[model samples]
Target chain A: MPRVVVDVVLKPEISDPQGQAVLGALGRLGHRGVTGVRQGKHFVLDVEGTPDEAELREIAENLLANPVIEDVELHLSGD
Target chain B: MRIGVVTFPGSLDDVDAARAVRLAGGEVVPLWHADAELPAVDAVVLPGGFSYGDYLRAGAIAARQPLMRAVVDRAHAGMPVLGICNGFQVLCEAGLLPGALTRNSHLHFRNRDQALRVERADTAWTSSYAQGQTITVPVKNGEGRYVAADADLDRIEGEGRVVVRYAGGNPNGSSRDIAGVTSADGRVVGLMPHPEHAVEELTGPSVDGLGFFTSVLQGALSA
Candidate 1:
């Protein structure tokens, strides 16, 4: 099995609306001092069979990350 | 044509998306977030809804789902994929599309019939319409703001990747008023509006959204 690790990150300086809303709700609930929050996701895939890394990279590039706003880091585990 | 609509646990628009696909004359295959197969569908739709209950982030949790792996594979093979609303969030989160869907400038959840100009109708999912065509579709979301750096924004605009722009008003303060965009090859599209809800006249603000589904079907058949 080939393991693929994906790290998703938001662009710096982009305001996270969901994070802001949570911060506001937390403040209203009397929990202050939350400075800043940005949210993203990570995925680890263990493919059952070996696939071409170039093809997989194409997948990551086209369907995994939007090149305009998000950055994607791809790592292949277990050669 | 067989179109797959993925349903994450918290997804609210999968059924509607399937219905739209069926109405557009394609067989609908319901896909689950945990699945690893794409069900042999010619195209896929990552439907709207608060996937993973908007945990961590709006589309962040759902973006890591197992089915997304298969979607990534098929989409790379040039399978047509469309992301709507929260699905759009997942696309960005999954790194399929560019730009993040943040909160509205007014910081409110907005639900309204929005007018959008089809800026580029050459994409696989939008070729049925003409460029500069104005269509009304329902837009509903809290995190709908779209932003990118000036350079990337210029490149996206200059490369003709922008598919739709808010026509009447800047609903969510999206940079360049962009509401939707297509991939470089035009096979994958991500948009913030709820087009599935507008596929039928009786159930929607306009039947204009039928073109999106039909366009994909037509494109697939022609290809």
Candidate 2:
């Protein structure tokens, strides 16, 4: 009953045109104080066993995110 | 001279890929995603489409399928492989090639005849063309922007693994304007363009795409 959550985002150096478009839309809508925004992917995994950091990293590295253009962040709980 | 063409769940180009193979004077062997065996084929072609419904990223799911396992193994053993469009995504996801295809910079699903230069004609999939030759092929996809780490880009560029690049103009904002690449040994190649769709002048911009199929067939025969 262990749970793992992952967030994958484009590397900082890479341009995210979609994210920029969203930011522009937000500005157009008169949303105040939201200076910047970036878009990414999120995944929640319900694994059979307690997945250690390495296992979680392996999942993110191999499947959840592409290492070439995205960086992955992991959160584990419900141990 | 048998070539295997893998058809994933959402593949749209398998038939065209098979036809291209046949036109190139090679036998076509249809491969399924669930099959673990690759059968007896000199080379393999992973056709394109929204495999796995483009969920969890295009090509990520299809790359881990059983058929790709055998294909990847065979590719590593120096067998020739060509991945087109979504298949190119699968190849990169499987680590048979480098980089990844993200959503287009323009945020549009582009479909057009694209001009490309054969940067490395020595590759197995490009043997029919000369280096720096320009050819037209149809490119269609939403997630087709190729990206790689700076070091990786430099490495591939230095090794002459960038097999083809956008010639007339950059279509998808791919890094270094790269449209296709090959492995270190030039046995495995992946590209965003659908050469299968461009093999015939009747339905395509030109018959130039036929060369890729012919190149693979000749490479397999000579190997």
Docking quality (DockQ) for each candidate: 0.28, 0.73
Q: On residues A7-78, what C-alpha lDDT tens digit does candidate 1 reach at each position?
A: 766677565666777778888988878876666667777776785788777867655555556677778873
lDDT score at residue A17, model 2, on the 0-100 scale: 83
Model 2 achieves a DockQ score of: 0.73
Q: How far off is each candidate at the interface, as Cα RMSD in Å?
A: 4.4, 1.2
lDDT of 1 by residue, B36-135 (tens): 7667888889999998778656787788788997897778889999999988888778777776777687787889999999988889899889999999
Show the colliding residue pairs in model 2.
none
**Can you write out model 2's per-residue Cα lDDT over A11-45, one digit (the tens) per residue?**
98778889988988998999867887889988888
TM-score of 2: 0.95
**What lDDT tens digits, residue by residue, belong to model 2 across residues B114-203?**
999999989889999999899999989888998887888899899888988998888888999999999889999999998888877689
Q: After superposition, how far is residue B194 of candidate 2 from its true place, in Å?
A: 1.2
